[model samples]
Target: MSAAGPRADVIDEHVAALSAALHGPARAKSRLIGEIRDGLMDTAAAHAADGVPRQRAARLAVREFGTVDDLVPSCQRELTIAQARHTARTVALTSPFLVACWYLAGSIDQGQAWQLPRTAQLVAVHLAGVATFAALFAAVALAATGTLARRLPTPRGLPLVVAWAGTTASGAMAGAALALVTAAALATDWPLLVCAGALAAASHAAVAASARACRHCARLPVT
Candidate 1:
């Protein structure tokens, strides 16, 4: 009708306001905007059918979507949880690589190809590896298997627990690595120990970074 042009302009303004209020990955923001536009159009169409003027209908539709202040926090919470979930998945995928790196570094330092002694130190290191694997797996499973979606859609349990476990495991892994490197350095030359320690340190750093990111996302203010 004659109001089509003004209706489009109104929709553009609403979309712009909504877009400016959102913050997250570009893909997610785009998808959200698409949904919002669809909703706005539907609302405007409904209002038009009810004999509302086109411009007034568009404004009403925008109002129905809520103010920027009211919607921003909701969008932020969703985006933050999404970021945390993504980081958790990345940590899960990298966990095996990290474990292998730690094992390689530790074995090289111990100067033995396959010597896993029953000593207390060996037991502790093994336990730390097991704990790290378990924690990362739990996080990945929750995110991937739809369990998190069904039960605790907005809860912080999944990401927070994973971050805490990852941090604790990192500390334990670092201690074990230091002990192994020290023992090797005392028994052998420094070159091999240094190389192995560097590799272990790099791997641990990656896991730490992932966990820290997840923790930050989890703590994002929903207010």
Candidate 2:
């Protein structure tokens, strides 16, 4: 009997053990087994292409007998946890910069003497709140995308597309926010203008930092 012949029995034993371990979830176990079988088949095909006899390659693949139902789920959970942690870190890192930008914009408005009409001042505050919320949301989305770009299984081109799109959008938003602040400066009294300008500068700095972080994250090889 060939070495390959002996391997089939070893694989069968392992599969039996896996089935026993997964006794309570037959359907899930079956699915996991199917995935393992497919992976093994792919490996066997590769081996055959590299000159192993078809029968020997099939036998060799039998070594990958056990389903990883429990293991796979645990790995998935861990991945989810890690992703959450990464997102939290990204947000924490970016928030201060955003706040600083807002403050700078406010300072610029103050410098410009932009005394708003009482109604307009209320409107401006409301708008600033909305803008801050939007900035936070955008930052979170960009950071999440950066995380996905690191983890998702995809063609090389897909990640590049996502990363570039995110970077471009971020840059554009930053530019627009700056323009709005500058316009506010021109239109308002000197104090308000100074505050707005300061806020714009802060925002620009935050966005610049975020863009750099995203680029760095994108360049990292997926683990």
Candidate 3:
């Protein structure tokens, strides 16, 4: 982003267009933009050193970089991978806490209130197990798109896989949390209930936000 010349201004506008056309995790997008800017500037500097006018060098650099439409599909691939990895990691990391919250909430009741009904507890436990399995499945997707990516043919629609797995895992976590909340309320474990409620809120919020970004990235047409 040089501010000194009309050609620099043109290149800046070009870069902005490229940025506008992309959507993904902010960090990944920012990193990609930074790399592009640095590259353009470096190329412009090289031309300037070779006796080209600085302004003209900037114009040449912009042209050499190709059009936004040409660059964005490649940039988007990277962003989509970053987004998918982030979502999978969040789901995997949150799974343990999701289970622990339920376990601790139920255990700390101490009989101060009515015991949770056995049937409901069993159902909640099974649902929590489902959530755990989904989280683990997300981890598998993570691996597929990561280290194993180089070793295996990248499956088409891998982003969709990550999105759905993360969504299912987070959705199941929310369901089980809601069920546990009901059981806690029935048992009247106020302190335990609040703790579990907070955990559920924070964990679901993180997973849901990442899953949403993942979903958008998955559905984003080969831009």
Candidate 4:
């Protein structure tokens, strides 16, 4: 019985030491998380006082954290649950537009209108030009998305709306470009139209799926 008692005491001492070590880290992380959350709230409040839209406020709040990639990793390290959740939500909302842009670019690249008449060739060339622009836009969006994923704040509400609206408009322009290219392609080989249309549709669908995932993630309660 005497031997067992000493063994039990030694185990208890070790457990206490381990717990103390864990507690220190936990408290530190909690403090850091609190700071980030408070900062975000303050930014929101300030933006509100300025009569800015909530989305813009959210975006500006995030911008204060620096770039998305830098912010995400920092938040992750601190285990800032609220900050992480908000950043994730922003990314979710914007992913569809990024995906759509990429899809449009690819469609333009593969469209068959370039093989047709002089007018059709000109239209195809224009479509290609538009694709090049979309590629650049996609690159930017990808960087932004990656940054946001890592824990950066993205613009919310009005700014988010404006950004997405701009993206949608760009998509519309891409569609128009596609139509011009399609028309020219049909003047040559009608079969390519099906492939081009499929590519566009598939890309749009992919974006929608990505957007859905982001929305779903946003709705999840933070632990």
- Who wins the lDDT comparison? 3
- Which of the predicted structures, 1 or 3, would earn the higher lDDT when compared with the native? 3
lDDT of 4 by residue, 82-146 (tens): 33233334333433443443343334343444543334334434544454444445445545444
Predicted model with the maximum TM-score: 3
Q: Model 3, range 145-223, lDDT digits (tens) per residue?
A: 8899999955658877887877787776676667667766666555665566567667778888898888898777664
lDDT of 2 by residue, 110-207 (tens): 44444433233334344455445544554555455466647863333332333343344334335535544545645544455445445544544554
Q: Say which prediction, candidate 1 or candidate 2, comes out ahead on lDDT.
A: 1
Local distance difference test values of all predictions, in order: 0.62, 0.46, 0.77, 0.43
For residues 20-114, write the lDDT of model 1, one tens digit per residue: 76655466678877888898888998999999988888889988988777777777667665655555565555455445544654453454443
How are the candidates ranked when ordered by TM-score, highest leading? 3, 1, 2, 4
Measured against the true structure, the TM-scores of the candidates, in listed sequence, are 0.61, 0.32, 0.87, 0.31
Q: Which regions in candidate 3 have their CA more than 4 angstroms from the true location?
A: 1-3, 105-120
lDDT of 1 at 73: 75
Q: Looking at model 4, which ten-residue stretch has the lowest summed lDDT?
A: 16-25
How many steric clashes between backbone atoms does each model show?
A: 0, 39, 0, 7
- Candidate 1 ranges with C-alpha deviation above 4 Å: 1-5, 49-51, 106-145, 152-154, 157-216
